[model samples]
Target: MNIFDRSKHIYLSPDFEEIIKDTIRFFNGTPVHSISIAERFHGTGVYAIYSIAKTGIYSKFHLVNRTAFHIPIYIGKAVPKGWRQARQGLSENTRSYELNNRIREHSRSINLGEGLDIGDFFCRFMILEGKEGDLIGTVEAALIRKYQPIWNTLIDGFGNHDPGKGRYEQAKSDWDVCHPGRSWADKCQGVPANQEVLLQSIENFMAGLNSEEDA
Candidate 1:
Protein backbone atom coordinates (compact mmCIF):
# COMPACT_ATOMS: atom_id res chain seq x y z
CA MET A 1 0.00 0.00 0.00
CA ASN A 2 1.10 3.61 -0.49
CA ILE A 3 2.44 5.19 2.70
CA PHE A 4 -0.21 7.94 2.66
CA ASP A 5 -3.22 5.76 1.78
CA ARG A 6 -4.25 5.41 5.43
CA SER A 7 -5.11 9.10 5.67
CA LYS A 8 -8.68 9.06 4.41
CA HIS A 9 -11.49 11.55 5.10
CA ILE A 10 -15.04 11.65 3.70
CA TYR A 11 -16.48 15.04 4.57
CA LEU A 12 -15.57 18.27 2.79
CA SER A 13 -17.07 21.74 2.98
CA PRO A 14 -17.85 23.54 -0.26
CA ASP A 15 -15.10 26.10 0.34
CA PHE A 16 -12.50 23.41 0.85
CA GLU A 17 -13.75 21.48 -2.18
CA GLU A 18 -13.28 24.62 -4.21
CA ILE A 19 -9.79 25.10 -2.75
CA ILE A 20 -8.78 21.57 -3.77
CA LYS A 21 -9.92 22.12 -7.31
CA ASP A 22 -8.12 25.45 -7.38
CA THR A 23 -4.92 23.88 -6.13
CA ILE A 24 -5.03 21.30 -8.90
CA ARG A 25 -5.65 24.02 -11.46
CA PHE A 26 -2.73 26.00 -10.09
CA PHE A 27 -0.43 23.01 -10.51
CA ASN A 28 -1.45 22.64 -14.12
CA GLY A 29 -0.37 26.24 -14.79
CA THR A 30 3.16 27.41 -15.47
CA PRO A 31 5.66 26.90 -12.63
CA VAL A 32 7.51 29.75 -10.86
CA HIS A 33 10.65 29.93 -8.74
CA SER A 34 11.84 31.93 -5.75
CA ILE A 35 14.48 33.82 -7.72
CA SER A 36 12.02 35.41 -10.12
CA ILE A 37 9.16 35.77 -7.63
CA ALA A 38 11.01 36.74 -4.47
CA GLU A 39 9.17 39.96 -3.81
CA ARG A 40 5.80 38.45 -4.75
CA PHE A 41 5.72 35.52 -2.27
CA HIS A 42 5.12 36.43 1.35
CA GLY A 43 2.42 34.35 3.01
CA THR A 44 1.59 30.92 4.44
CA GLY A 45 0.86 28.38 1.69
CA VAL A 46 1.35 24.95 0.12
CA TYR A 47 3.76 24.69 -2.80
CA ALA A 48 4.24 22.12 -5.57
CA ILE A 49 7.99 21.93 -6.23
CA TYR A 50 9.67 20.95 -9.49
CA SER A 51 13.23 20.32 -10.67
CA ILE A 52 15.05 20.06 -14.00
CA ALA A 53 18.62 19.47 -15.13
CA LYS A 54 20.41 20.34 -18.34
CA THR A 55 23.32 18.02 -17.55
CA GLY A 56 24.01 14.56 -16.10
CA ILE A 57 23.40 15.56 -12.48
CA TYR A 58 19.71 14.60 -12.19
CA SER A 59 19.52 12.26 -15.17
CA LYS A 60 19.32 9.13 -13.00
CA PHE A 61 16.10 10.08 -11.24
CA HIS A 62 12.66 9.26 -12.67
CA LEU A 63 11.55 12.64 -14.03
CA VAL A 64 9.18 13.59 -16.82
CA ASN A 65 10.48 16.19 -19.21
CA ARG A 66 8.34 19.10 -20.39
CA THR A 67 10.39 20.87 -23.04
CA ALA A 68 13.17 22.30 -20.84
CA PHE A 69 11.45 21.69 -17.49
CA HIS A 70 11.35 18.36 -15.66
CA ILE A 71 8.92 16.59 -13.32
CA PRO A 72 7.55 17.84 -10.04
CA ILE A 73 10.00 16.66 -7.40
CA TYR A 74 8.34 17.53 -4.07
CA ILE A 75 5.31 19.07 -2.39
CA GLY A 76 5.50 21.11 0.82
CA LYS A 77 3.47 23.28 3.21
CA ALA A 78 4.69 26.21 5.27
CA VAL A 79 2.70 27.66 8.17
CA PRO A 80 3.64 30.52 10.48
CA LYS A 81 4.43 28.84 13.80
CA GLY A 82 7.14 28.01 16.30
CA TRP A 83 10.13 30.31 16.00
CA ARG A 84 8.97 31.75 12.71
CA GLN A 85 5.44 32.55 13.82
CA ALA A 86 4.20 36.11 13.77
CA ARG A 87 3.71 37.60 17.21
CA GLN A 88 0.44 39.11 18.34
CA GLY A 89 -0.38 42.63 17.08
CA LEU A 90 2.16 42.27 14.30
CA SER A 91 1.45 43.97 10.97
CA GLU A 92 0.32 42.11 7.86
CA ASN A 93 3.83 42.18 6.43
CA THR A 94 5.20 40.44 9.53
CA ARG A 95 2.88 37.43 9.20
CA SER A 96 4.15 36.25 5.83
CA TYR A 97 7.61 34.82 6.46
CA GLU A 98 6.79 31.13 6.74
CA LEU A 99 6.27 30.26 3.09
CA ASN A 100 9.07 32.43 1.69
CA ASN A 101 11.60 31.26 4.28
CA ARG A 102 10.88 27.63 3.56
CA ILE A 103 11.38 28.19 -0.15
CA ARG A 104 14.65 30.04 0.48
CA GLU A 105 15.92 27.14 2.58
CA HIS A 106 15.20 24.77 -0.31
CA SER A 107 16.95 27.09 -2.72
CA ARG A 108 19.96 27.08 -0.42
CA SER A 109 19.97 23.29 -0.43
CA ILE A 110 20.04 23.12 -4.21
CA ASN A 111 22.74 25.73 -4.55
CA LEU A 112 24.97 24.26 -1.84
CA GLY A 113 25.86 21.28 -3.97
CA GLU A 114 28.23 21.96 -6.86
CA GLY A 115 26.48 19.51 -9.15
CA LEU A 116 23.00 21.03 -8.77
CA ASP A 117 21.74 24.42 -9.90
CA ILE A 118 19.18 26.57 -8.13
CA GLY A 119 18.09 27.94 -11.52
CA ASP A 120 16.63 24.53 -12.33
CA PHE A 121 13.90 24.68 -9.67
CA PHE A 122 10.41 26.14 -9.96
CA CYS A 123 7.12 25.82 -8.05
CA ARG A 124 3.37 26.21 -8.31
CA PHE A 125 1.82 27.38 -5.07
CA MET A 126 -1.22 28.94 -3.43
CA ILE A 127 -1.13 31.38 -0.57
CA LEU A 128 -3.40 29.98 2.13
CA GLU A 129 -4.75 32.93 4.09
CA GLY A 130 -6.70 32.34 7.34
CA LYS A 131 -6.50 28.59 6.70
CA GLU A 132 -6.08 26.04 9.44
CA GLY A 133 -3.30 23.45 9.50
CA ASP A 134 -5.61 20.56 8.59
CA LEU A 135 -6.77 22.24 5.41
CA ILE A 136 -3.23 23.08 4.42
CA GLY A 137 -2.17 19.50 5.11
CA THR A 138 -5.07 18.17 3.06
CA VAL A 139 -3.95 20.13 0.00
CA GLU A 140 -0.33 19.06 0.35
CA ALA A 141 -1.20 15.41 0.90
CA ALA A 142 -3.51 15.43 -2.09
CA LEU A 143 -0.77 16.79 -4.35
CA ILE A 144 1.77 14.29 -3.09
CA ARG A 145 -0.64 11.44 -3.77
CA LYS A 146 -1.34 12.76 -7.25
CA TYR A 147 2.30 13.28 -8.27
CA GLN A 148 4.03 10.61 -6.17
CA PRO A 149 7.06 12.93 -5.97
CA ILE A 150 10.45 11.33 -6.21
CA TRP A 151 11.87 13.12 -3.16
CA ASN A 152 8.72 12.51 -1.13
CA THR A 153 8.28 8.83 -2.08
CA LEU A 154 11.56 7.03 -2.74
CA ILE A 155 14.30 9.38 -1.48
CA ASP A 156 13.25 11.01 1.76
CA GLY A 157 14.65 13.80 4.00
CA PHE A 158 14.33 16.77 1.67
CA GLY A 159 12.41 18.49 4.47
CA ASN A 160 14.62 17.55 7.43
CA HIS A 161 16.45 20.02 9.61
CA ASP A 162 19.41 19.69 11.94
CA PRO A 163 18.80 17.32 14.83
CA GLY A 164 20.19 19.37 17.64
CA LYS A 165 21.92 18.20 20.83
CA GLY A 166 22.11 14.39 21.23
CA ARG A 167 20.06 13.18 18.25
CA TYR A 168 22.74 12.33 15.69
CA GLU A 169 22.85 8.54 16.08
CA GLN A 170 20.17 7.69 13.54
CA ALA A 171 21.07 6.81 9.96
CA LYS A 172 21.22 9.58 7.37
CA SER A 173 18.22 10.00 5.06
CA ASP A 174 18.08 8.62 1.51
CA TRP A 175 17.98 12.19 0.23
CA ASP A 176 21.32 12.94 1.83
CA VAL A 177 22.75 9.90 0.07
CA CYS A 178 21.54 11.14 -3.28
CA HIS A 179 22.25 14.83 -2.69
CA PRO A 180 24.60 15.63 0.14
CA GLY A 181 26.12 18.80 1.70
CA ARG A 182 23.48 19.78 4.23
CA SER A 183 25.90 20.59 7.08
CA TRP A 184 23.82 19.18 9.94
CA ALA A 185 23.36 15.92 8.03
CA ASP A 186 27.09 15.30 8.20
CA LYS A 187 26.89 13.98 11.78
CA CYS A 188 24.24 11.34 11.13
CA GLN A 189 24.92 7.69 10.36
CA GLY A 190 24.74 6.79 6.67
CA VAL A 191 21.84 4.91 5.10
CA PRO A 192 22.46 1.27 4.16
CA ALA A 193 21.87 1.98 0.48
CA ASN A 194 24.24 4.31 -1.30
CA GLN A 195 23.40 6.69 -4.12
CA GLU A 196 23.60 3.95 -6.77
CA VAL A 197 21.22 1.66 -4.86
CA LEU A 198 18.75 4.50 -4.36
CA LEU A 199 18.96 5.29 -8.05
CA GLN A 200 18.15 1.66 -8.89
CA SER A 201 15.14 1.75 -6.58
CA ILE A 202 13.84 4.84 -8.39
CA GLU A 203 14.27 3.06 -11.71
CA ASN A 204 12.26 0.11 -10.44
CA PHE A 205 9.56 2.39 -9.10
CA MET A 206 9.31 4.24 -12.42
CA ALA A 207 9.08 0.90 -14.24
CA GLY A 208 6.20 -0.07 -11.97
CA LEU A 209 4.48 3.18 -12.84
CA ASN A 210 4.79 2.47 -16.57
CA SER A 211 3.49 -1.08 -16.05
CA GLU A 212 0.45 0.20 -14.19
CA GLU A 213 -0.24 2.83 -16.84
CA ASP A 214 0.10 0.32 -19.68
CA ALA A 215 -2.12 -2.29 -18.02
Candidate 2:
Protein backbone atom coordinates (compact mmCIF):
# COMPACT_ATOMS: atom_id res chain seq x y z
CA MET A 1 0.00 0.00 0.00
CA ASN A 2 1.07 3.66 -0.44
CA ILE A 3 1.45 6.25 2.28
CA PHE A 4 -2.03 7.76 1.80
CA ASP A 5 -3.49 4.32 2.44
CA ARG A 6 -1.60 4.23 5.70
CA SER A 7 -3.15 7.46 6.99
CA LYS A 8 -6.58 7.65 8.62
CA HIS A 9 -9.06 10.50 8.74
CA ILE A 10 -7.29 13.01 6.47
CA TYR A 11 -9.14 16.24 5.84
CA LEU A 12 -9.24 18.79 3.01
CA SER A 13 -10.78 22.21 2.94
CA PRO A 14 -13.17 22.60 -0.03
CA ASP A 15 -10.71 24.58 -2.19
CA PHE A 16 -7.94 22.10 -1.64
CA GLU A 17 -10.32 19.40 -2.85
CA GLU A 18 -10.59 21.11 -6.24
CA ILE A 19 -6.84 21.33 -6.70
CA ILE A 20 -6.50 17.66 -5.82
CA LYS A 21 -9.16 16.65 -8.34
CA ASP A 22 -7.75 18.78 -11.12
CA THR A 23 -4.24 17.46 -10.53
CA ILE A 24 -5.41 13.85 -10.58
CA ARG A 25 -7.57 14.31 -13.66
CA PHE A 26 -4.67 15.94 -15.47
CA PHE A 27 -2.25 13.21 -14.44
CA ASN A 28 -4.59 10.19 -14.72
CA GLY A 29 -3.06 9.28 -18.05
CA THR A 30 0.17 8.97 -16.13
CA PRO A 31 -1.96 6.72 -13.89
CA VAL A 32 -1.59 8.15 -10.38
CA HIS A 33 -3.88 6.95 -7.57
CA SER A 34 -4.11 9.00 -4.39
CA ILE A 35 -5.29 8.62 -0.78
CA SER A 36 -8.68 9.98 0.19
CA ILE A 37 -9.70 12.70 2.60
CA ALA A 38 -11.11 11.32 5.84
CA GLU A 39 -12.46 13.61 8.60
CA ARG A 40 -13.55 17.23 8.59
CA PHE A 41 -11.65 19.48 10.93
CA HIS A 42 -13.06 22.47 12.76
CA GLY A 43 -12.65 25.33 10.31
CA THR A 44 -14.90 28.05 9.19
CA GLY A 45 -16.44 27.97 5.68
CA VAL A 46 -14.92 24.88 4.00
CA TYR A 47 -11.87 22.93 5.15
CA ALA A 48 -10.89 19.24 5.47
CA ILE A 49 -8.01 16.77 5.65
CA TYR A 50 -7.58 14.03 3.08
CA SER A 51 -5.69 10.81 2.95
CA ILE A 52 -4.15 11.40 -0.52
CA ALA A 53 -1.72 8.88 -2.01
CA LYS A 54 -0.18 7.65 -5.28
CA THR A 55 2.35 4.88 -5.23
CA GLY A 56 4.59 2.41 -7.18
CA ILE A 57 6.39 5.14 -9.05
CA TYR A 58 9.62 6.95 -8.47
CA SER A 59 7.70 9.21 -6.06
CA LYS A 60 5.10 8.61 -3.36
CA PHE A 61 3.21 11.39 -1.52
CA HIS A 62 1.47 11.06 1.85
CA LEU A 63 0.58 14.09 3.88
CA VAL A 64 -0.95 15.38 7.13
CA ASN A 65 -2.04 19.00 7.56
CA ARG A 66 -0.86 19.47 4.00
CA THR A 67 -3.20 21.73 2.12
CA ALA A 68 -1.58 20.89 -1.20
CA PHE A 69 -1.91 17.52 -2.93
CA HIS A 70 1.29 15.43 -3.01
CA ILE A 71 2.87 12.75 -5.32
CA PRO A 72 1.60 14.30 -8.50
CA ILE A 73 3.18 17.69 -7.78
CA TYR A 74 6.33 16.54 -5.97
CA ILE A 75 7.78 13.87 -8.26
CA GLY A 76 9.37 16.04 -10.91
CA LYS A 77 12.78 17.51 -10.16
CA ALA A 78 12.15 18.63 -6.61
CA VAL A 79 15.42 17.82 -4.82
CA PRO A 80 16.08 19.12 -1.34
CA LYS A 81 19.60 20.40 -0.55
CA GLY A 82 21.11 17.37 1.19
CA TRP A 83 20.37 15.11 -1.77
CA ARG A 84 21.89 17.63 -4.13
CA GLN A 85 24.98 17.57 -1.97
CA ALA A 86 25.05 13.79 -2.25
CA ARG A 87 24.76 13.96 -6.04
CA GLN A 88 27.93 16.05 -5.94
CA GLY A 89 29.24 12.83 -4.31
CA LEU A 90 28.91 12.80 -0.56
CA SER A 91 28.88 9.44 1.24
CA GLU A 92 25.38 7.94 1.42
CA ASN A 93 25.69 7.24 5.15
CA THR A 94 26.80 10.82 5.80
CA ARG A 95 23.88 12.11 3.78
CA SER A 96 21.39 10.04 5.71
CA TYR A 97 22.84 11.13 9.05
CA GLU A 98 22.50 14.82 8.30
CA LEU A 99 18.98 14.42 7.00
CA ASN A 100 17.64 12.45 9.93
CA ASN A 101 19.10 14.83 12.48
CA ARG A 102 17.53 17.79 10.74
CA ILE A 103 14.11 16.20 10.63
CA ARG A 104 14.36 15.08 14.25
CA GLU A 105 15.22 18.60 15.30
CA HIS A 106 12.32 20.03 13.33
CA SER A 107 9.91 17.40 14.55
CA ARG A 108 11.10 17.98 18.10
CA SER A 109 10.48 21.71 17.80
CA ILE A 110 6.84 21.00 17.11
CA ASN A 111 4.45 19.04 19.25
CA LEU A 112 3.97 15.41 18.13
CA GLY A 113 0.60 16.40 16.78
CA GLU A 114 1.92 19.22 14.54
CA GLY A 115 4.62 18.38 12.02
CA LEU A 116 5.20 17.75 8.33
CA ASP A 117 4.30 14.11 7.94
CA ILE A 118 5.05 14.66 4.23
CA GLY A 119 5.92 10.97 4.47
CA ASP A 120 8.61 8.33 4.13
CA PHE A 121 8.54 8.68 0.36
CA PHE A 122 9.73 12.26 0.60
CA CYS A 123 12.15 11.31 3.35
CA ARG A 124 13.53 8.47 1.21
CA PHE A 125 13.44 9.27 -2.49
CA MET A 126 14.07 12.89 -3.36
CA ILE A 127 11.80 14.11 -6.13
CA LEU A 128 13.49 14.35 -9.52
CA GLU A 129 12.69 14.64 -13.19
CA GLY A 130 13.40 11.41 -15.01
CA LYS A 131 13.40 10.60 -18.73
CA GLU A 132 9.65 10.06 -18.73
CA GLY A 133 9.02 13.10 -16.57
CA ASP A 134 8.95 13.68 -12.82
CA LEU A 135 9.83 10.62 -10.71
CA ILE A 136 11.26 9.90 -7.26
CA GLY A 137 14.96 9.16 -6.84
CA THR A 138 16.15 6.74 -4.16
CA VAL A 139 17.70 9.23 -1.81
CA GLU A 140 17.50 8.78 1.96
CA ALA A 141 14.37 10.00 3.75
CA ALA A 142 15.82 12.55 6.18
CA LEU A 143 17.69 14.72 3.65
CA ILE A 144 14.59 16.43 2.23
CA ARG A 145 14.46 19.36 4.65
CA LYS A 146 17.45 21.21 3.05
CA TYR A 147 18.05 23.36 6.14
CA GLN A 148 17.90 27.13 5.49
CA PRO A 149 19.56 26.83 2.09
CA ILE A 150 16.24 25.28 1.02
CA TRP A 151 16.88 23.14 -2.05
CA ASN A 152 13.47 22.32 -3.53
CA THR A 153 12.22 24.35 -6.50
CA LEU A 154 9.06 22.31 -6.80
CA ILE A 155 6.06 24.25 -5.62
CA ASP A 156 4.76 23.85 -2.09
CA GLY A 157 1.50 25.42 -3.19
CA PHE A 158 -1.41 23.29 -4.45
CA GLY A 159 -0.44 20.11 -6.31
CA ASN A 160 3.04 18.50 -6.14
CA HIS A 161 3.69 16.83 -9.54
CA ASP A 162 1.33 17.95 -12.30
CA PRO A 163 3.85 18.42 -15.16
CA GLY A 164 2.50 21.91 -15.88
CA LYS A 165 -0.29 20.68 -18.18
CA GLY A 166 -3.05 23.06 -19.20
CA ARG A 167 -5.81 20.99 -17.66
CA TYR A 168 -3.87 20.97 -14.43
CA GLU A 169 -2.93 24.61 -14.90
CA GLN A 170 -6.62 25.54 -14.82
CA ALA A 171 -6.66 24.56 -11.17
CA LYS A 172 -4.85 27.78 -10.41
CA SER A 173 -7.98 29.78 -11.08
CA ASP A 174 -10.18 27.32 -9.24
CA TRP A 175 -8.11 27.32 -6.02
CA ASP A 176 -8.27 31.08 -5.73
CA VAL A 177 -12.00 30.93 -5.23
CA CYS A 178 -11.60 29.57 -1.70
CA HIS A 179 -8.18 30.47 -0.35
CA PRO A 180 -6.45 33.58 -1.50
CA GLY A 181 -2.75 34.33 -1.15
CA ARG A 182 -0.81 33.59 2.07
CA SER A 183 -3.10 30.67 2.85
CA TRP A 184 -0.60 28.33 1.23
CA ALA A 185 0.11 24.77 2.28
CA ASP A 186 3.39 24.01 4.05
CA LYS A 187 6.11 24.97 1.59
CA CYS A 188 3.04 25.41 -0.57
CA GLN A 189 2.06 27.28 -3.71
CA GLY A 190 -1.14 26.60 -5.63
CA VAL A 191 -2.46 28.03 -8.87
CA PRO A 192 -5.87 29.61 -8.62
CA ALA A 193 -8.97 27.35 -8.52
CA ASN A 194 -12.67 28.10 -8.37
CA GLN A 195 -14.05 27.50 -4.91
CA GLU A 196 -17.57 28.13 -6.25
CA VAL A 197 -17.42 24.58 -7.55
CA LEU A 198 -17.44 23.28 -4.02
CA LEU A 199 -20.09 20.58 -4.41
CA GLN A 200 -18.48 18.72 -7.28
CA SER A 201 -15.03 19.01 -5.73
CA ILE A 202 -16.17 17.54 -2.44
CA GLU A 203 -17.67 14.60 -4.27
CA ASN A 204 -14.39 13.74 -5.96
CA PHE A 205 -12.38 13.91 -2.72
CA MET A 206 -15.08 11.90 -0.93
CA ALA A 207 -14.56 9.09 -3.41
CA GLY A 208 -11.04 8.69 -2.04
CA LEU A 209 -12.13 9.26 1.56
CA ASN A 210 -14.98 6.76 1.31
CA SER A 211 -12.77 4.21 -0.34
CA GLU A 212 -10.57 4.31 2.74
CA GLU A 213 -13.62 3.58 4.87
CA ASP A 214 -14.49 0.62 2.63
CA ALA A 215 -10.97 -0.74 2.89
Write down the lDDT of every candidate, Cα atoms only: 0.68, 0.28
List, in order, the clash count of every candidate structure: 0, 44
Please write out the lDDT profile of model 2 over residues 62-151, one tens digit for every residue.
332134432222221233344445443334343223323333322232122121333321221111222311122322121232111111
| 133 Cα displacement, candidate 2 (Å) | 18
Stretches of candidate 1 off by over 4 Å are 1-19, 34-37, 60-63, 68-70, 82-93, 132-134, 190-192, 205-215
Give the range where candidate 1 is weakest over 10 consecutive residues by summed lDDT. Answer: 206-215
